[model samples]
Target: MEIFAIQGYVDLVVFVVLLAVKLFAFINSLLWSAESYEAAGKLTKPAWTIILGIGVLLQFIGILFILSIAFTIAAFVYLADVRPALAGLRRR
Candidate 1:
């Protein structure tokens, strides 16, 4: 395959994966209350929601979308690390 074609496919995959990540984070945030975020020792609920939402929006903005992945780091951290802790807390 042409290098350009290969690169384009790679970019597309990145875009889709990031979009899904942010979307999942945003949706998951809805299941938790503001207190849950705080009790979970994570970023505030609204702050995290906005961050995830912006990450999703950035994905549609031409080449700059890739930079949005920086925000995903935080969102994913909450999802992967914090959310589980929060779930465990709720079960207690």
Candidate 2:
């Protein structure tokens, strides 16, 4: 019983962290200009916005775990790859 309780807490932490990352990615996507995405050779701003938005929404609802994981991967891609490309353009 104690182990189950600990596992529940761990699961809750994971869920919260996933939601935070998705929310951050969605918000950051909104901050960049459409032109910045084009200049960086990434997807259009609207596309990213929609993708991240859906991810955040799905994560928040917490019903479909598989879909949530898929969207989480999308968030990671935006943060790890597309974000740096856009940030690079901003620095130059």
Candidate 3:
């Protein structure tokens, strides 16, 4: 059980760290794409820019939600596995 708890914590930490990296990548991709489109002069149209922005925002939100769900599951598993042992350890 102790070993499982340790593994769980490690998994949770890794998940969060990876999620952060992914989020950074997503934001950078969106910004770069938008800038590239603008540089090409196609992004001059307000409507088109708005449409692209909304689409990118939606995609970003979706990815964020997915990452949040993944981390939530990892956290729940870690807590469930380790709470008992942690409490016991505290008593000593």
Off by over 4 Å in 3: 34-92
Q: In model 1, which range of ten residues has the least summed lDDT?
A: 60-69
- RMSD of each predicted structure: 2.0, 0.6, 19.2
Model 2 lDDT per residue over 1-92, tens place? 89999999999999899999999999999999999999999999999999999999999888788888899999999999999999999789
Ordered by TM-score, highest first, the candidates read 2, 1, 3
For residue 55, model 1's alpha carbon misses the true position, in angstroms, by 1.2
Comparing 1 with 3 on lDDT, the higher-scoring candidate is 1
Clashes (N, CA, C under 3 Å) per candidate: 0, 0, 0
Q: How does residue 44 of candidate 1 score in lDDT?
A: 86
- Model 1, 10-92: lDDT tens digits are 98998788778777877887788999888877788888888877776776564464577587786688788877977898889
Which structure is stronger by TM-score: 2 or 3? 2
| Candidate models: Cα lDDT each | 0.79, 0.95, 0.46
Q: How accurate is candidate 2 locally (lDDT)?
A: 0.95
Model 2 CA deviation exceeding 4 Å by range = none
Model 3 lDDT per residue over 1-92, tens place: 89999999997786556555444433333443344434444323344334334434544455565645554444343234333333444366
Cα lDDT for residue 51, candidate 1: 80
Can you rank all candidates by lDDT, best first?
A: 2, 1, 3
